[model samples]
Target: MRVLLVEDDQFHASYMEDVLAETLPEVTEIFHAMNGEEAEHEARALTIDAVVMDLRMSRRNGIDAARTLWMERPETRILFWSNYADEAYLRGIATIVPEDSAYGYLLKTAPRDRLKLALRAVLVEGQIMVDREIHRLQRRAASPRNTLDDSEFAVLLDLAIGLQDRIIAERRGMSLRTVQNRLLSLYEKLGVDDEASDAMPLNKRVRALNRALVTRTLNIETLETAQRDFDRWQSTRKRA
Candidate 1:
């Protein structure tokens, strides 16, 4: 398999190349890029089987580049690598990629073997591998406002991410009062009577809900796979 790797850090880029070469001997060729712009250009220029991208970059950012690649190369698989485990990023990416595609979002600190496994799963199974932390975050976002309409769910997601009502309203092109009212309704549905209750800050409550969602969405088999992936990651770290 041919792969395109986009990462700015020299050490990580080199280390990843070495690991992939040693682990997946079938990866015949690997192309490297130092930034998002280069990645975007290379992605368009090459006939790569899959892309391994770093999220943080000096220009464009991984998500933007991934979106571009997804639009331009619908058949190419994308594997996102980031240090952040933010839910908003996951949701934003999900909005772009189809569920059937070979896509994955993983933490930069993930074990090398787990990274290899994620790539294999995408290439072989066409499954998207989400970092467990991201799955947890999504579950949290989904849980807190299960009764929320689509708009309300969007609003709550923004709220949990610390977006102000006015900012969210402007982004959604709705009035601030509408946002407030939606939040009030959501609180009622969640049975959260006190807005300032210690038991449920919007962020904390959302995270808890996300954990629950991950549990519900994953079956025993998939859960076992995730555990094995994580275990592989741990083992790689120990060796390193």
Candidate 2:
């Protein structure tokens, strides 16, 4: 089988290549891409059977690349190998993946045997294999009452980045009331209720953002992604 290996670090990529070559006897050709942009190019240029994708890259992130690839070919099988199992990454993956598509998420720190098993499960057996911790997060996110919906999550990101409610409404194409309602839901999901007993009145938005960060729901990478998007939007507005 032909496999696409997408990673930024050359040494790590070489190491993973040796691992795949040694473990998976079915792999005939392993295509290497330094980043997601190159991965996209290789996927288009080659007849890749499956992919072992790294999440964070210099040009484009793995989630964005996987989303595009899956959009073009829903049957694409990919095993996400990353150092992070952040909720933001999971949410990003959950949003784009096709319902029936088989995919896996394994951290880079995993034992070589575990990595081999995950790759075999995703690439050969066509099974879903997510790290146990990430799977727990997925379960929590699946709960409608306790988890933020996509719209709520979007509002939460806006709040985290210090956007006012009016600005968020305008940018998200949501009504001001809708934005406020989403914020309320976000607070409830984040358990940011009633800081009245505190020495000072705390901002619920800030509290919610803090709770999310502490809970690993919002990480630095999440904010960085949002910041990049905000920067792009600002550039477009300036151009206009």
Candidate 3:
């Protein structure tokens, strides 16, 4: 079987190659790509049986790249190897994966045995293998009581990165009122307004962000990715 390993760090890529070589004897050829953009090109140029992709990359994120690949070849198998299990990344993966496709998500900190098992399950046996720690987040994501919808999630990311309501409204192509409504919904879901009788009430926006962070609903990696996206958007706006 031909496998494509997509990771930005060369050391990590080499490590993955070694692991695949040692674990999966059936893997005849292992291809490596530095990032998602290169992964896309390589997959299109060659016949890849399975892909091991990193979640975050400089050129393009793995979720976006996987979507493009699946658009062209829906049968392709994928195993996401990421350092983070952030909600945003999980949500992104859930959004793009085909209904019948076999896929998996494994954290980088997983034991070698678990990693090998996940790789085999998704890449060879065609099964779903999500990390145990991520299962709770997955359950919450599916739950309507506390989970943020796509619109709310987008607005939350914007707010987390210090975007003003007016700026978010303009960037998202929504009215100012719509932005405020989304913020209210976000705060509600995060329980930002639920204060104890003795505790001081913080600013709703700050409290919402704090709660999201405390709950692991929002994280540094998610914020970093959002900042990059925002920066790119701002650059495009400037150019326009």
The most accurate candidate by TM-score is 2
TM-score of each: 0.63, 0.78, 0.72
Distance from true location, Cα of 183 in model 2, Å: 1.3
Q: Give the local distance difference test score of model 2.
A: 0.86
lDDT of 1 by residue, 30-70 (tens): 99998878988998788888888887777667776777888
In the range 1-240, model 2's lDDT, one tens digit per residue, is 999999998887998999899888999999999888899999999998899999988788898789878988888899999988678888877878898888999888888888888888999899988888666656765465667778999999989999999989988999999999998878878878754346777789889989889877787767877887788887997898
> How many clashes (backbone N, Cα, C below 3 Å) per candidate?
5, 0, 0
Two-way lDDT contest, 1 vs 2, winner: 2
Off by over 4 Å in 3: 136-145, 149-151, 154-182, 194-240
lDDT of 3 at 144: 68
lDDT over C-alpha atoms for residue 90 of model 3: 79
lDDT of 1 at 118: 79
Return the lDDT, model 2, position 39: 91
Of 2 and 3, the candidate ranking higher by lDDT: 3
Q: If both were scored by TM-score, which would come out higher, candidate 2 or candidate 3?
A: 2
